[model samples]
Target: MSHTLPTDIRLHKKSRTLELIYGDINYELTAEYLRVHSPSAEVRGHGIGNGVLQTGKQLVGIKGIQPAGNYALKIIFDDGHDSGLFTWEYLLDLCQNHDQHWQDYLQQLQDAGASRNDGMIARG
Candidate 1:
């Protein structure tokens, strides 16, 4: 199935959220969320089952966003991460599965004994 491209995209600097509008649906994704779920090789890795768990991204923010050709958006984060090219379909999927994805990420962090806050790892 094909996903429709967002009709509007805005970066809420103060709130650190990226707002995307697709027809009547809207999604507000946090900067930290985008940072942790980045599609870059550093985050997603080169193969399956080798994905890295991102931690300490609770306060990340978006620096800017640029259109990549006609297929994706290149998101630049305040923390110097600028490699991910978020395709329209991927963005839509993220929006649609935000809650589930977030929950899974939280569970992963907990299992790894990692905290969202910088430099802190809790012991089980």
Candidate 2:
């Protein structure tokens, strides 16, 4: 309900990207990035060391974006991940620190001996 909310949010199927426009600034987020960085507890886990690492999302695409009240967007990934509530602040942070965050993600995968081509991590 605030005027600071994003004016436009669009998913481009051809490009496999989400575009967010807020005032005069615009951000383009790849579905891959969104998937890897989902805000769900399933991805983020419960505590500091409990976070789950997401892998093999390089080709993921956004299936849809639904509103969560007036504060966040629920993004459904083509891979069937739909629990994350992407709040305005979180989305903005992702847009601003994407490069660093992406690098960290790649490093995490390397450290875990994981490959982005291997699909999601198998959970028991």
- List CA RMSD, all candidates: 1.4, 3.4
lDDT of 2 by residue, 1-124 (tens): 4544788998897799999998889999999899889999999998888888888788888889999998999999989999999998889889989999999999998878777877655443
| Local distance difference test values of all predictions, in order | 0.92, 0.88
| Residue range 69-118, candidate 1, lDDT tens digits | 88899999999999999988889889999999999999999988998988
Candidate maximizing lDDT:
1
Compute each candidate's TM-score over C-alphas. Answer: 0.95, 0.90
